[model samples]
Target: MKMMERLETFLVLAECGSFTEAAKKLFCSQPTISHHIQKLEEQFGAPLFIRTGRTAQLTRQGEIFLDYAKQIEQTMLQAGSAIESSMKTESSIVSVYVSQYFANYYFDEILPTLHASDPPYRLEINAYCYEALKQALVDRKTDWAIMPYYPDDDFIRSDFAVHALFEDEFMLVLPPEHVLMNRKTIYARDLQGATVLLPRSPFLIRSLQKEMDRHGLRVQYLQMSNFEVIKQAVKSGLGAAFLPYRAIRKELEAEELTAKRLPFFGYLRQNGVLVRKGARFTAEEQAFFERLRPHFDEGAPAGRSAFS
Candidate 1:
């Protein structure tokens, strides 16, 4: 009996030209739809619809009133949008969480491009270590992430939504002066007895370890918490690292860090965007993603995980 409900029902019935179809759209019984239409007709003291055997046609008065109903609907939509925006402002914190290394290495250039948006919003770049980033998404402390892909798990599949951001491949990086850089084609034998720097993500570590064990390789590993640190360490001859090539391209171009042409054994890492399922992205969040979408233009993921 609410004004908007009655108006919406009338609009649906008019558009469908059938009481039965309107009932289905509105998820109500046909009689309920009919009764709603009847009440509106009586209020205006005019036959709004000419019901003829499961179909309805709007009369002249009904046609005239449809304009007013549409205007009301538009107004309601605007009002709802305004209310939602205001509510978001009152709670006022928009943030995208990711690994600190990703925030600096990957998104640093991509994020600054958003500075020209009208009615600017403050998007907090909440950076954390790998384990903390996963927990934050699971706990709903943050909504969106700009990070590498992780295989789906119970919490990820059930509670979070995954978006494949880009197809990335791991590169073995060493100092430019390292002996491995002189090799024409790097192989597993080249990495024998080397100290490999690794990120703290369990999934990546596990996947890499499995591959190493399968390949019958033996190497000393040093676990690092950030990509930048790992890169810097490799550049300083502290150790070598398997990092996403796209992430460390600047270092490659500048000849600061050297990438060995070792076979990764078809292990391609997929970068991804993770948000809590059913979370609404802010305007800035949507725009930031659109700018970065070109990198992820692999069409669709051919594989789910690095090894899978």
Candidate 2:
């Protein structure tokens, strides 16, 4: 608590830019604010402030420490909220980080149903791209992350406990009038000399590129991070893209876009749940994960792939 207090005080002082103003905001003495900053500087073995004019300015070291100070402040606030929420609701809230596509396609439907289930458990979903999702897991901001499996991904292999939920096969999406629209199976070479709309996330983008390059296909890209944006871009005839079938179920069924099976485009992205290494799951958390399993691959063909 004392460490948190010091950090909170430092954050206020940094924001207010004056010891007196910070003290006024905190309802503490100006001397106390000065003392707190001094203590932090001593602990870090550097000066935190440059005392000049009316407002105190952060030194180079203080600027670097500001980020950590802010993080500590946020953690403290979440901790307080958790305690209050537990007392009122008696429900444990689970924080989850989901990929943009998974959140839009599945979480949109899944959350409402979960909320109304018997013995309801609270779930908070934070949507991020692959890189941001990985960082959220490592930073412990989320209890679990729902993301796609990428080849040689160290986050899945080393730092987290993973469960293979289901496979979501990619569908090649093209405008209705495209040349490859009638093809039952498309090859990577078919995409050569064409612009492929893909997410800006490095991991997923790299995964897409690697598979194409494996088949000696070269292509241009119209890159955007969000699935909806890419879907719209494909619809606008920007270019063709490979996307999860579940995400574009309506579009596929409505014939808003044409989908072709890409035989040589062989990257089976397995979506899974990942938790920080060695974190023990309570019964509620375990049940929540179980409840979501059936909905994991809604795109699965009746007898075959999850993303049909």
Candidate 3:
């Protein structure tokens, strides 16, 4: 018999305190129990039990082995339980995390199609700010992520794979009737001293600042953290802001905001699907990601074409 099986027999016999009783409990004959115990004692090079008239008593060595045997059994049980839990979680649900921007602009656009396809697994999708989403991806707390910003860290690059889905431009957004609407082309210097709405997150604000510095543009800032709020502010003629054109496509179509092309801001943000390197995804999970990629149009708006 295997060492583990022998150890299990030893544990049960030790608990029963009688060879005959142990055999009865294990649904085996008394001689079979004797054989297993004898094999165990021989392997350990000591007597694990002492026979007294009708009862079996543990020896000193047996007590020490008993502790180790119990520990091994408990470890095996816990390992089994953890693996089972992991399997259930993976098979039943697909966990995906998205940046706040992607969730806001693309989630509703994609949901109806996803539902119509009738996927096998349930989806638990969460939207987080850029910083929070980055942290979650680094910690492996999410199975998949869709975000615009990719961390420039070597560890992240080596440990994760990023599939570029689509590109969206960060254009100069202004109220439809703003003075700049008449300008055929907008340059960074054109907005000098203009009040520009800024995202509130420190990480995002810092990134925007670096881009502005690179282009040699200086503007007064009005901080509004939420994207929806920023769009509202622009519609209300609060200020001109730099925002992803796709994010404000509907508003632009309705003439609520006038979007101007800024050559310097082009190709600044590429939204992509991010996943851990060397992960074994379930069939359902893989199917979901495959279906999702086609919804984003490259170098254009979302929901247009497959990744090309």
Top candidate on lDDT is 3
Q: Over the stretch 93-196, how does candidate 3's per-residue lDDT look in tens digits?
A: 76778888888888887877887776444778889987788789778787567886545555557877777877766778889898888988777778888888
lDDT of 1 by residue, 230-275 (tens): 9888877888888878768899999898885467454677667766
Clash count for each candidate, listed in order shown: 0, 3, 0
Q: How much is 264 displaced in model 2, in angstroms?
A: 1.8
Point out the worst 10-residue segment of candidate 3 by lDDT. 299-308
Model 1 scores a C-alpha lDDT of: 0.76
lDDT of 3: 0.79
- Model 1, position 201, has a per-residue lDDT of 77
By TM-score rank, best first, the candidates go 3, 2, 1
**lDDT-superior candidate, 2 or 3:** 3
Give lDDT per model, in order: 0.76, 0.78, 0.79
